[model samples]
Target: MRIGLYPGTFDPVTHGHIDIIRRACTLVDRLVIGVAINRDKGPMFSLEERLAMVEAECRYLSEATGTEIVAHPFENLLIDCARDVGAQMIVRGLRAVADFEYEFQMVGMNRTLDPEIETVFLMADAQHQAIASKLVKEIARLGGDISHFVTPTVARSLMDKLGRG
Candidate 1:
């Protein structure tokens, strides 16, 4: 089976992420959503919460697309995480030129680490290209509507996280 790893912090899974996940299903039989445990980012949600959100969001997508979607938590190098999941490809979502520049550098580093693993970039749909988790959180924290960016469940979670719910 062709397995792909898509790694991200996913502090709160946004619509942009769902768009990528839905599109990524076409490329691989199994898509592993790697929820990064990066303490450096100071995530608004806990690893468990993030995992639950990712898993919940992916369940419907998996059923709809007939693809196996699983959420895995990882604190190690992304390349190592891909190896652990036995993934032959790393799927990344690109929003803009800025995202491409960073992802390009990451692809190069990952290739050096494991020349056999390929990285695939999927451009975010136009509707979601501007939606980012960080911006979603900020908007929620400031008492702005985030319904357009995240699912209702995630929006509620963000509100609760910010003590606004």
Candidate 2:
């Protein structure tokens, strides 16, 4: 089976993330959503919370697309996570040139760690290109509507998490 790893903090999974997950499903038989435990980033959601959100958001996509989508929490190196999941490819979503610059460096580092595991970059759909988890949370925290950037379920979760509801 062709397995691919898509790693991210996913503090709160946004539409942009769903877009990438949907697109990545087309390329791999099994897409592993690597929920990174980056405590340094001080994510709004805990690892378990993020994992639940990713699993919930991806459930329909997996069933509809006929792809096996699973969330795996990882605190180690990204390449190690890929290997642990038996992934042959690492999927990344590029929103803009700024994202590319950072991803480019990551790809280089990942390649050095494991040249056999290739990195694939999927450009976010235009509508979701501007949606980011951090920005979404910020908007929600400031009492702005984030319905456009996240699913209703996620928006509610954010509101509940931030005590806005």
lDDT of 1 by residue, 80-148 (tens): 999999999999999999999999999999999999999999999999999988898888888888999
How well does each candidate superpose onto the true structure, as a TM-score?
0.98, 0.98
* Candidate 2 Cα outliers beyond 4 Å, as residue runs: none
Candidate 1: misplaced stretches above 4 Å?
none
Given candidate 1, what's the lDDT at residue 149? Answer: 94
Displacement of residue 120 (Cα, Å) in model 1 is 0.2
TM-score of 2: 0.98
Q: What would the TM-score be for candidate 1 when compared with the true structure? A: 0.98
Model 2 RMSD to the real structure? Answer: 0.6
Evaluate residue 49 in candidate 2 and report its C-alpha lDDT on the 0 to 100 scale.
Answer: 92
